[model samples]
Target: MKNEIKGCIKALGKLIFSLDDVLNEAVEFPKEHFQPCANLKTNLKLFAAALQKIDGKYMARKDECRRLMAQEEVALAKCLCHFRAGNFSMDLLQKAVTLAAVYGTRRQAKEMKREAQKIAFQYDLRSQNKNLVTDSKAKWEIMEQLMADIAHNINPADYQPEEQIAWEQILDSFEEKLREKNLDLKGMDYNSEIEELFTSAREAVVPLKLAEKLKEVAVERTKKQKTLLETLERGRE
Candidate 1:
């Protein structure tokens, strides 16, 4: 799993470098119609650096995998936002969306695919920017092939980490432990084994030092869900 994740990220980094190279060539190609954004190369460079820095070893543990995936998704999001904020071409937009869909969870991939479809719709509606549209079309086949190769090398489950642990899951685990220890919570059995079980349950659910971190995760997850819903609503409208 670690090797697979590392390979996927390496492939993505290469793709970003190729993209940056293309942008650089476009700058020197003596084209009047399609000038790349000033910060486009910088953004791509930063994003590539971020991807290269991801610790693929984190896949060894579930909690580490969760955090690693979150960090990766955030980097992708920041790159996409940078592109959206500038006057980048349609191809750049599609590329960002493709990367996001590939690296994100199932829900994230679904949302990104919707965004890509919307881009296609808008491309069909607009009469101007034919050169830009043509350029995007020419690159689409190659991009698809590259993405396919990358996707084939990765495990889908690695991208789809369990984002949150439900309260019921921990409660069920606690209950099972209680049953094994033959200790009733409401009974007058205050033995050391019962005390240890309670301690373990508390540690599993909420360690003292990690409580604030867990709260932050909850808040961040909520914010992401809210943003995704709003994006979906806007797409519907």
Candidate 2:
């Protein structure tokens, strides 16, 4: 029984490492890619299922260990009762001690099993939380990139009156969603907001549009700095 319990512990350790690796890889995939979402969701469900199987096995082993411990206790009690009933002999006393040792060993095994079960439960919860966070972050990153791309491609001045109104409304709706998710970009300048959205998008996957937009923003900023410097020099003269 001791050897069996040890083996179970070792197996559980390996399972934990395997699950961690699967989740890490799933989380690292690019959010803009369809494959990441599909893979992450599928793997997360599979991990949960695997955990269920491990939990079932753990419960079975625990029940068996409890039953064995209870049996040992009963046998020990019986031996004590016989000794109390004046059947005290060297043989009976030795038998009682043997039963006591078995009970002690069984109790230790139960403790180990209980500890392992606690660790497993904690790990399962951590894995579930990680899945949720990664999924949410990926979705947010994809949305951010899409919004940034739209912003970069469409100039406010080039739109017709009706198109401008409709585009603003759409942007407003998107901003509202971000607010609802507690991701506020309120009070941030256009360039700063764009940079932030780009940063968030790059957290999961780097979109080509993001790089192009960043380059454009950088050039615009440099031109503005140059104009400002020229104005200051004229003022000095």
lDDT string for model 1 (1-237, tens) is: 455445444444443456443233111111211223333224333433333333342344343233434344444534453433232345555665665554544454466567656755666523354423422221232222222222222322255323332333344565578688785554234456655664576468655566566557547756865664454345434
Listed per candidate, the RMSD to the true structure in angstroms reads 21.5, 30.9
Best by lDDT: 1
**Candidate 2 per-residue lDDT over residues 45-113, each given as its tens digit:** 332332233233333343213222332343443333332222233343445556443333344334434
- As a TM-score, model 2 comes out at 0.19
Model 1 CA deviation exceeding 4 Å by range: 1-79, 86-88, 123-128, 131-237
Output candidate 1 Cα RMSD: 21.5
Per-prediction TM-score to the true structure, in the order listed: 0.25, 0.19
Which residue pairs of candidate 1 clash? Answer: none
